[model samples]
Target: MFAQALRDILQPLPPKCDIPQDEQLQEAMNTLEVIVSLLLKEQFDTWRYEALDGILLTVAQRRDADTAFFGGDCILITDQTVSPIEVEVTLGGGGAGLVRVCCRVGEKQDGKLMRHSYDKEHRYRTLIWQERDPHHELEWMYFVERMYDENGR
Candidate 1:
């Protein structure tokens, strides 16, 4: 159980987009750290984000995936058996009453995910304070800049 706490962030940089890491990234990262901290602080009281297993951050720089694919990728967290807590955050803006954030954790495969672990529920929406936080909307954008194209290698 403890082993699942450690996650490997798999991110690749793109060739077409060539630019040094600037203050923008730092600002985003800072915002993300703060937002994540705030979420964890509040969410921990009822749910445990720390025990969410492994986290995967991915960014694609192409539109082959979809029409609205503005080079965005999904952030995934895998469980012990490699079940996915995939959160797809895109550029969203709307009215004050509506909070624009989509968070999804894929269900367990068929019978079980791994061993005795079986996912009872799947797919959800995470309440985010702002879009500038880590693992939020901008986090995906941060990763997209560092993504590698097909010719990157």
Candidate 2:
């Protein structure tokens, strides 16, 4: 099972990996959710909140040369409450398809930084400046919400 999962993840790219930019952002958000969910389950189960916080810092610091992670922005969480966390991510697009993209990052638990996606789907996340004129193109925007199973102590 592990081997198969690895194979699926390490699978080669398609002949032309052309996709919408919004799709790319959505995929990234989903990926983060699954990863954070699994990691939190493991950490929270073993060491509780302490383990969760410790592992979060550790995980956020991992990245490759192309997909680097950085402390772009952060929020402070103090109160012990059960609620969804919301975040906004703005990335200036480069290369071919899109010139900029934005996405919401935090959820109910926490947020982490990782390698940025270079997929063409980033085009969907681009923001438009229709207010100015037809020749106006602003950065993209996205709204993400992190929902917990319950809202309680």
* lDDT to native, each model: 0.26, 0.25
Per-residue lDDT over 28-124 for candidate 2, one digit per residue giving the tens place of the 0 to 100 score: 5444444334444443442133211101110121122112121111222222211212222222123111111112333222242222222332222
Q: Per-prediction RMSD in angstroms?
A: 15.9, 16.2
- Report the number of the highest-TM-score candidate: 1
TM-score of each: 0.26, 0.23
lDDT of 1 by residue, 86-118 (tens): 222222122111122123333334533222232
lDDT, model 1: 0.26
Q: Name the runs in model 1 displaced over 4 angstroms.
A: 1-46, 49-54, 60-83, 90-98, 110-153
User: Looking at candidate 2, what is the lDDT of residue 108?
Assistant: 24
